[model samples]
Target chain A: MSTPLISIRDLHVSFHTQDGVVKAVDGVSFDVMPGETLGIVGESGSGKSVTANAIMRLNFGTQVDVSGEIIMNGKNLLEVDDDELRTLRGRQMAMVFQDPLTALNPFYTVGNQIAEAYLIHHPKATKSEVREIVLNAMVKVGIPEPTKRMDSYPHEFSGGMRQRIVIAIALVNNPQLLIADEPTTALDVTVQAQILELIGTLQEEYGSAVMLITHDLGVIAETADRVMVMYAGHAVELANVDELFETPTHPYTVGLLGSVHSLDDSSRGALQTISGTPPSLINLPTGCAFHPRCRFELGENSLCRTEAPQLHAVGKSRSACHLPESQLLQIGAKGGV
Target chain B: MIYFVIRRLLFAVVLLFVVSFFTYVLFTALPTNPAALTCGKNCTPEVIARNEVRLGYDQPIHVQYGRFLKGIFAGRTYGPEGASVHCPAPALGYSFEYHECVTDLITRTFPVTLSVAIGAFVLWMGIGVGLGTLAALRRGRWQDRFATTFSVVGISLPTFFFALLAILVIVIWGGLLDFPQYTGFTENPIKWFSGLLLPWATLAILSASTYVRLTRNGILEVMNEEFVRLGLAKGVKRRTLIIKYVMRAAMVPIVTIAGLDFAALLGGAVITESVFNLPGMGKLSIRAVTDSDLPVLVATTLVAAVLIVVANAVVDILYGFLDPRVREKV
Candidate 1:
């Protein structure tokens, strides 16, 4: 896998707020292979975005407490100084935020913002070089008449166009890793499809590892090569896109897929919904955090209540559940596939 | 942009007229008679009647207001017969107390007030915006605490009291500054600056406190904006992130308030000017009031009205420059 572009091993992020500690991202481990797309799917507060932000060390020196190694090219990002991190951030990895309207500074022109990242990494680049890079990125992101739109403020552009500019800014430096935190969540469905396609095309051209974070499983289905399903700040399932869809080993994944009504479905009924809200990170459920909301706790085995399940191989994937393999397969057949 | 300016100027002109009308009516309605005050302690009822006729006090309020407007446009003569003096165009009538033209007095004293106001404006804006940004950056730290404490002291302390105390410390005790005196800029630039230094610092201290609080709040709000985070993600230097993204955005509100404060200061830093014994507009206005110089009072009030309206208009225009939403409206 070319040593995987970046490796995150047991990354933990907690915030020490005034009220108490919030365990935002709890012991997550993953790797992004070069030119591959890894989707982290979860609802709000599930820590998908937090995990992405931690890779860039965006939470450093705040109330956040981050532990464990984020190794890229044989160096721990967490241990790097401000100077090293500054050089590494946009040059090696960059992030696109969720809200395009707010993601861009309204005061500056779009071209200036794109050029900012390029200039920071290539400080010795001339003004003409910077301009070329900025124009190329704008065109690459499918912005029509890049020259005309380059000088416009963010407010002057439509929501979809603004997101395109933001994507252009992120890709300007040609970073090895691109973290998109719900890049299209703020756009309408049509625009979302276009942005997704654009991202796919650009990823192919750049050959950079992508970490796509979103709450929509549908988005992950279309764009991600591999998927990681998170629930209550824990990785509940991890698998290839086809394998995960064909047989979801985790009960939460089954519930998530079951809720999505498709045109091809033979059974016509109301969508099945998962019950109960996500557990509070401050005071999580004692055993498995999802067990209280999970419907598949068996009669004989009380281990789901007394002990937390750890990730283990099920088929071609891994899941965090204590249910026997046969029962999981039955659940998957009855719901997902 | 032209339409915006024309609209703002039209509004300003209307506002000035309204302000001047009210001031004129209020001064005329006062219990003391302008003519009688001018006539002094002379005993005869005949003298009082003649003085009223000469001063145009015998005419109705509307008639006097009309004549007053006319005098501003075209030169007019004041008093009666042989003693009547010719007041030039933009005339504001004659000051009974000083036996001088009100407009002339205002024009003479205006330069001193403007110099003081401008110097103090620079001082306050620099201190307020600079410290405010610093306090916001170092929030929850000792520097922020010190700025907060300084602001509290500035807000609560009276301007006159602060002026006096500053004089005692800087001029009398420390000899760090010269006692304020009105030296015209054209005459001696060094003396003019040194003389106004104490007044500048005193005014800055009072005004900067508010700016500090405003700036700190503004910067804090801007820091939370998503663009700031994006700037950081772009590997922008920390200093660039703050100045380019945060500070520029934060300056909008600060600049707005500063314009208004400047207008207020120009209208008169009465207490500050009085403490320093500088012959600025505030002192002139005070003298007019104590002596019951109706012409001088009304004229100064009108000037203040004009200053405030013009200042507001200027601020509005400047706001458009900072915020694109306003700029694009034109």
Candidate 2:
């Protein structure tokens, strides 16, 4: 897989808060192949965002405790010194944040904001060179009249335009990897499609591996090559998007699919839903974090209550569940519990 | 931008006229007679009546106010023809209390007050913003705790009390320097700085506490803004992020408050001036109140109003430069 542009192994991130230590991310591992999109889908507080932030070391310098190996270009991101990390951040991997309105500084012109990121990596570049690059970036992101709009502040633009500016800033450095955390959540439905399309187009153009983090299943279905379903800070399932959608082995994945409202399926009854809210990270249920919300019955002497399930091969996917592969297949064939 | 400033200045001029009219009317309504006061202890009825005619107090209130306004533009003549003393155009008024022009008293005492204001402003901004930034950067550490304690103590102490305590500790006990005295900055810059140091420190300590709270909270809030985080994610150095992203945003409110505070100080540091025995506008105004010197009181009030109005305009213009959002609106 082209040596996997970035590899994460057994990543764990915990935040020390007043209540207790929140295990925001726990023992999650994945790989992003060069020039491919990896979608991380989870509900809020499921540590999807936390995992992405950990890769960039954005979770550092706070009360967060992170330990694991994030190997990018053969260097462990978690172990690299701050200077090296900074040098790699925008130059090798850049991030597009969720809220465009706030992601860009209001005091600076959009052009200057984009130029700032570029200049950090190209400090000795002349002013004219920087301006030309900034203008080109603005145009690449579909911003009309780049020169006229360059000097406008973030507040002066519409929501979609602002997101475009943010995307422009992220892509200006032409990093090898792009981590977009809910890049369309703050945008309207129509703009969401445009932004997703823009990211896809940019990915193809730049040949940069993309890590797309969002809770929207449709977004993943539309863009992701490989999908990772996360629950309570754990990766419950990982597989190619088609295989995962057609034969989701994990009960949590099944529940997620069952909950989605299919426009073409009018015969389907009231939308199916998981029985409970997500478990608190500070104090999760025993054995399986998803057990409390899982619908399938647990037979006598079931290990689901006493021992945690580890990720294991099940059909075409890897799932963390105590159920036998045959039984899971039968349940998956039935669509949901 | 120029249009906005010009509009604000025009507004200020109208506001000054309204303010001066109010002050003139309020002081004139008082029971004390300015002619009687100026007539001295050996004054007789005839002498007081003659003094009233010369001072134009005998005219109706509105007419006197009109003449007062006119005197500001065209010099007024006092007493009879040949013996007339012509107060220059742009005159504030004649201060019979100080036996000098009201404008002259202000021009002289304004320097003292201005010296105090500038010194105190510099001290407060430097210490307040500096310590506040330090505290915010080292939040929850010992440095933050120290700054918090200092601010609480400063906020609790009144200006007069702090001034006296400062004198007692620095001058009487520690023998650090002489007691504060007003000295012209151009005459002897060294003595002037030394003389104003105590008042400056006293005023700054009292005022700096507010700014410390403002700056500390402002920085802490801005540090959490999404833009600052984005800046960090963009590989900007931590120092650059804190200064350019965090501080640049935080300084808006701080500058707004600092401008108003400095302008208010320019009106006079009343208690601080009295405690330091500096012949500033604050002390002059206080004396005007005690002696019922209406003209001096009116002039000081007008000067204070002008200072505040001008400061507000300046702050509005500065706001445009600080934040682009404001610039477009202007």
Candidate 3:
């Protein structure tokens, strides 16, 4: 197999708030192969966005505490100096944020904002060259009338158009990896589809690895090659997108899949829901964080409530559950909790 | 833009007219008699009546008001026909106490107030924005605490008291500067600057406190904006991000407040000027009030009203330049 474009090892991100230290991202690890899209699916407060931010070292300067290895291009991102990190940011890895409305500077024109990203990396580029690159980026993002729209302010554009401008800025330098955190969450359903398709098309064109973070299962099923299910700051399951859907081993993953309303299964009366709220990050349940919500029966001397489950191989996927694989497979085949 | 300016200007004219009318009526309604004051203490009732006629005070209120408005557009004759004094058009009024045109008094003293205001404006904005930026950048640190303390003192202390305290400390005690005296800028720029320094520092310190708080809070708020975060994530240098993104967003409201504050100061730093004993409009207005100089009071009131109106218009226009969202609508 080809070497991974980026590798995260035992990453932990926490924030010291007025209340206490909130473990936003407990020990978690993953990898993204070059040119492949890895979908990070989780509920809110699951540290999905925090994990993406850690890879880019975006949480630095803030009160967030990050300790882990984010190895990209033979350098630990957490250990690189600010100057080196800046050089790699827009040039080696760029991020597309969630809300385009506020993400783009309202005071600046779309063209100027896009040109800024290019200028930061290529400080010596001439004005005309910079303009050409900016216009080209605008065109590549499918923004209509690039020359005219470039001078327009962000407020003048619709939400979708603003997102396009944001994407243009992120991809202007053609970074090898693009981390998109809920890029479509703020957009309408139709616009969301267009934006996702645009990202997919751009990934193919640039051949850049993508770390797509979202809470939408359909989005992952349609776009992601490999899927990682996170619950309460822990990655509970990891598998190929199809394999995970066919045999979700973790109880939490099984509950998540069961909750989605399948259009094809018209006879399914009511959507199944997990039994409890996500455990607080500050004080998680002992053993498995999801045990309070798990429906499967406890085995003899069951460690489900006394010990945390670590990710282990089960068929073609990896899961963090004390439950036996055969029992999970049976639950998966049933397709409901 | 031209239409907007024209509309604002017309509105200012109407507002000035209303303000001047009120000033005329209110000052005239004072129990003191302007004619009797113009006449000597030994004057008789007959002499006062003749003086009243000569001064055009005998006319009905509305007619006198009409003549006052007319004096602004066309010169009006004062005293009897043959011995009449013809003040030029745009003549605010004739100040009998000073034996000069009210317009002339303002024109002469305006430069002093202008000098004080302009210098103070520069000082306050520089210190306020500079310290504010520092406080915001180093929030919760000693520098921020110091700035907060400075602002608190500024807001709490009365302008007159602060001006006196500044005089007592910087001039009488420290001997670092001379007492404030009004000197025309054209007469001797050095003396003009030195003479206004105390007033400038007094006003700047008091006013800068507000701006320090404003700029500090404004910058802190802008720094939290998502656009600033995006700028940082774009790998833009820290200095560039602060300047282009953070400061740009923060400066919009500051510009508006600064413009209006400057306009108010230009009308007259009433307490500051009085404390400094500068021969500005504020001192003249106070003297006019004590002497019951009706024309001078009306003229000063009109000038202040006009300044505030013009300032509001200018601030609105400046908003267009500072914030793009306001540009099209403005």
DockQ values of all predictions: 0.76, 0.81, 0.73
Q: Write the per-residue lDDT of candidate 2 for residues A1-337, one digit (tens) a residue.
A: 3599999999999999999999999899889999999999988999999998999898786688999899998999999999999999888999999999899999989999999999999999999999999999999999999999998999999999999998998899999999999999999999999999999999999999999999999999999999999999999999889887888888999999889998888888898899989998999878888988888748545777777788899998898999989989887877732
Global lDDT of each candidate? 0.88, 0.90, 0.89
Per-residue lDDT of candidate 3, residues B1-330 (tens digit): 667667767877787778888878887877877787665679899988988998888899898889988998997777554666778988888877887888889998888888989999999999899999999999989999999999999889888888888888988999988887878888999999999988888899988999999999999999988788788778998888889999999999999999999998988888888889998887788888888888888888888878988899888877777788887675
Misplaced by over 4 Å in model 3 are A297-302, B1-11, B22-26, B29-33, B80-83
Docking class of 3: medium
What value does DockQ give for candidate 1? 0.76
Error of 2 at B164 (Å): 1.1
Report backbone clashes per prediction: 0, 0, 1
Candidate 1 segments whose C-alpha is farther than 4 A from its true place: A266-268, A298-301, B167-180, B186-191
DockQ versus reference, model 2: 0.81
Q: Which 10-residue span in candidate 2 chain B carries the lowest summed lDDT?
A: B77-86
The candidate that achieves the highest DockQ relative to the unseen native structure:
2
Give each candidate's interface RMSD in Å: 0.8, 0.7, 0.9
Native contacts matched by each model: 0.70, 0.81, 0.67
Better of 2 and 3 by TM-score: 2
Order of all candidates by DockQ, from best down to worst? 2, 1, 3
lDDT of 1 by residue, B1-330 (tens): 778978988998899889988999999898877776555575478877787888788899999999999999997888767888899999998886887888889888899899999999999888888898899999989999999999999999998888888888888999987677889999999999999998998899988999999999999999989899899899989999999999889988888888888898888889888899989899999998898888899999889888889999999988888887678866
lDDT per residue (tens digit) for residues B122-214 in model 2: 999998999899999999999999889989999999999999999999999999998888779899999999999999999999888888889
